[model samples]
Target: MAAPTKTLSVADQLDQLQAARKLALTTPVYYEKIVKGVLPIIGPTAPIELRRWGAEFLAESLATPVLAKNEKESLTIAVLDTIKALLESGDDDPIVLKASIGAAASAYPIVVRWIIFNSYHPDPWEQMSAIKSRVFRIWDTAPPPVKLACIKFAQRIVLAQTVSNGQEARLYPGLDVSLGMITGSHPILDPRRMEAEATGLLDRMLGVLQDNSSDALLVDGTLNCLSILIRTRPSTSNRIINCILNFNPLKLANSPMTPKTKVLVKSMEKTTRMLLIHIIKRDPNFQPGAPGSQQLGRIQQYIQRLERSKTEIFDEAGRKRALADQSSAQYGDTKRQRTETPAAVAVTIPPLGPGPHRYSALYTITNNAGLQSFDATQVPHQLATRIVVKTLSSISQGVLDFAIAGIRDRLKTFQPAPTPSFAGAPPPGAINPATAPLGVEEGDDDYEPNFNAAEDTEQILNKLDNAPPEVPLDHTEALDLGPFTLPSPPLLDPDTAIRLAQAAASRLFGPLSSLKEEGSRKPRAGINRLAASSYDRESWLTVVTRLATRSTAGLESNFKKEETGRLALNDTLREMLFVYILEDWRRRIEVAVAWLCEEWYNDQLIKLSGSGAPLNYEKYALRLIDGFLNYITPQDKVLTRFLAEIPELSRELLGKCKTLCGDPTTVNLTLTSMLYLVMMRPPVRAIALDTVAEIWQEYVDARPLAAKYLTKWRPGFIESQTIGQSSAAASA
Candidate 1:
């Protein structure tokens, strides 16, 4: 007789239900089962696991695009009662609430469309309305995931109820159930009421953004909703943007930041930035003072404020920059060491020599255990074939002995007993254990050894260890067939590799490099190398210059005589500095001025230390100044500002400035340089006045240009110069 059927336990039933759910969701033909079979299994009376699974299944089935609109509509009608029961059941299970609310979100619009079309079946609409009401009642008190799901659900309601234009209707069909979609509203279905409900829900979502103490999940959820609504609904864009404008993403706490608050701040700022970027990109044709220009401007300004707040909240201690400074200091020290001893640490490109004429090993066999455990299939096909061929080639008599011994041991350990030679028994050729030979077993008999089995296995292992090495396959040599020879593999050693890379780079960058040089011959590299004018390079130069100039005053005081003369801007670096400035002096003039000022200041510091000779500071300073005078044109006004900003105006530098007197432009340039020193640079004012007085007495070309600004700037100097001229005339 057939065995009686066994009943499944609760867990077994849940497992079967899960299996069915997966099959239904994965298979397109079984998708209808989610609404029909799956919907009946989830009720108030069902198990929680079954209900959770059913809720999640309905959620996926409804949200998925695989199901057609009519299929989804029917599914929505079938699952509305279950969704309402799941939401109102007050299970407090996050999975149930999240899945049920998510399902409701996907089903909400379909049910609204159904009610709009039929106007007779109001049951689904009422069920969905009840589900939404239950969700709202628990939204504030629910867990974060459930609350987030409800926020999305509310967004769907707003999108479905809000009236879409004709263009939007064609884009996303059947989503809108507005009065605009149909003529004459029925008593049961009021698009106006539905729209008002959506409006209230939108206000509620915005309220989360407005609250200073809202949860992080809620705030992010609300911003996400705003992003969707603003993109999908054009009518709500302005109000949403305005709401985002006033929302402070970092207003979570007024106290010092903890780890939790830090996470919240980061999440909120990231979401806010993404949303602002999205909104700005939608209408990026921004013209200042235009009709919609103010809105985008406000958004940009808000993003700036958000960034500043992030910096303040997260990096207020400057830890990131400090780490960068430490790293740069370490790298700078290493670079300095290398540059100091260039000959000792040479990097000569090694010559290309013929490599060993043998194929490379596919994998190194570290030990016998690793070799035994290694899987050849895991390797690539080409390598696996090479390994198999190599292994077969290396097989020897000792290896054959080891393989035979291994097979004998495995057979003896698992050998079955011999049965009598009958119809369904062992065959006539099967050995009887009593008459079997050594190391073989039969008929429940133990293995018989002619000698010690342990000693024999050890001898076989030793033989395996001493097996002959495989013959090497040399790919470098040509393979000769009966009438043909195959070519050798290509050589890719270090020297050839370097040469290949260099050739490729030269081909790609040859024209660009030439263009860089040609452009460098002029004032700038233009597009050839715009990095010369980049702000990062400018900031780097400024920072290092200030660090050396402002921070080295005390270092010179306690230094040994030899170390006291060590300037941050050494000879080679100074040469590079001069070239950098002369290449693009107009744009990088401030960098040059800062370096010169630092040099001048450090020169004073070294002088106070009573060094053997004047430091090279004056040498480098004069070189930079002369270089500028030589390279800068007569009408270039940038050099005037550069010279004025120099802290110390030495006599040698002033003498160079007094000699430019060939034309009106040259005279004006010289006079402007001297005038800026007298007016803007306070510390150099006296020396500049002295140079101006000397220029006024000595050079007639610069006198006319100097008199205009000097009269207003240094009236006393001009008068005293006139008196000195009179006294000199009287004495002469």
Candidate 2:
């Protein structure tokens, strides 16, 4: 008979969730049993480890296809609700926030769908407003990692809010669609509430980008959020462009070139450059700041760095020192931290343009409902002119086509109005220079043509002088002019009509007039061109490599050998960079994996070995070894095959691989890699094999391998007693 099944406790249940594979592969009965057992114990007092495990577990289950879809989504909401309740009840651990963010992200597809269906409904699970508000309250005070995760969560919500695929418009059947819900309208709520939620989230992201005190990681994530908004929400693209343009982060690049700021300044610049590229690609007409001008010398230098030879780029430190050395010969090192300067405050400028996306959606619905197609000829010239002027002042440079038809309509039907000259108005024949019509001479700025000639200008002026003061002119209504149809009454005074027309034409063509003066160059003043240059793809990796890969040679020459942190990259930074790399790995896992390895070896390991201080970087080198081992699970064959290209890890290598021991499958891969190490190196074969045995003896899959290796290899575990607790504590 099989051994009696042991009663599973909450701790055991929590441990089962460490591998997302378990959630995916397990049967429904088993999965629900595990969830049922652990659900009641998820609280602040719950073992921190269990809560952390449950956090990531719930996240994975939400996305897992194995579970009944409704069950997983309902579980996801419950998990979020529990976490939110704990948070409101005075439990605000960074781990809780971090894990909850992961959970939310895992359930994002369903959460977004549900939100779209019932944005205005009162269901607690669908109340994004309350959930978002609570998150914002803690966000300013949250830990750096938590803040980073929260921003990422916000990014997903913003991304799901595109105008087309986002709203499930057909879902709202019973509701009446109003005109405001039609084309060119910005609906605050409907089948969805994209407007209010996106606006709040965007404001928070901008606040982080603007705040000098924000952690660099937070700033990097915020920049990512801004890029998503720009790409996905075209209606607010101009506003997003203006916010990024106003905040110049390149100046912050002048900060001391230690490892951390280098990554930050580079990432910030890369994202900003990418956002600008998107704008330019979307609208070639956009002209922001002075195009191709020398005003952006910093951006120029950054582009030059990419164009230069590898040696020049790698030798940047030496070149920077040489420049400083020359000045030191005459005057001691003059370099100061760039942070000493007062930073510009972030200004959140509301979008001036109307919601073109909303408008388009409305237009579509109306047309399909058998509404009138546009009659271009009948659109009033006066109204169209006003729209043209308003469009110029509101939209981004790329959106000139927004009101182009209106403008051409007004210009094509130009009928000059007689200027109403009160005693105080600008001289009738004499032009008002400030209100001058385009192409009209400055001296004749207020010119209004007469039926006769310039000689009749005096006669017209005398007629205006004889007009009764304060008597309203004959209503321009109910009168049938030969060609003109008064949709509404025309202006009683011709002066009002004439002045309005002149202003509209001048405002519409002011930038174009400047472009002509500059002789065919792109007009360089607006919101888009104000940004830095286009960024190359690898530029982001190059910067991350510079910071994430440590070089002992680059350390301060006068610094003592005992200075430890200077020799190896910080563990947290390595982990964060890994997160960033893994995020990208989803797109091109092979390339990202190869680049991560090549970068680590070339930039870090080579430098340490060449410096003759191999021991100084042992921790850093071993972490990479263990990091790769931890990442590749038994099921991940492609990453495993790519892993083979890396150099043989030393049997002497050992560091805390927190992710390695978390799941049985990953632990299995770690032992396999260790055994492979034994196969390759005969000298450490016994030692490496014995090391694997000690780490894997407890698992059924590992036991046979451990026993077989132990019979051949005579050695013992290398610091074996510490393995289990070490993995558990990292989660804690």
Candidate 1 backbone collisions, by pair: 418-443
TM-score of 1: 0.42
My TM-score estimates for the predictions, one after another, are 0.42, 0.35
Model 1 per-residue lDDT at 595: 78
Off by over 4 Å in 1: 1-6, 166-168, 175-179, 283-294, 319-732
- Cα lDDT, all candidates: 0.70, 0.53
Instruction: Write candidate 2's Cα lDDT for 346-394 as tens digits.
Output: 4331222342334333223222334335554577999999988997799
Worst ten in a row by lDDT for model 2: 173-182
Clashes of each: 1, 12
The CA-based lDDT of model 2 is what?
0.53
Cα error, residue 438 of model 1, in Å, equals 79
- Most accurate candidate by TM-score: 1
lDDT of 1 by residue, 618-661 (tens): 67667777776766566688767767566666888888877775
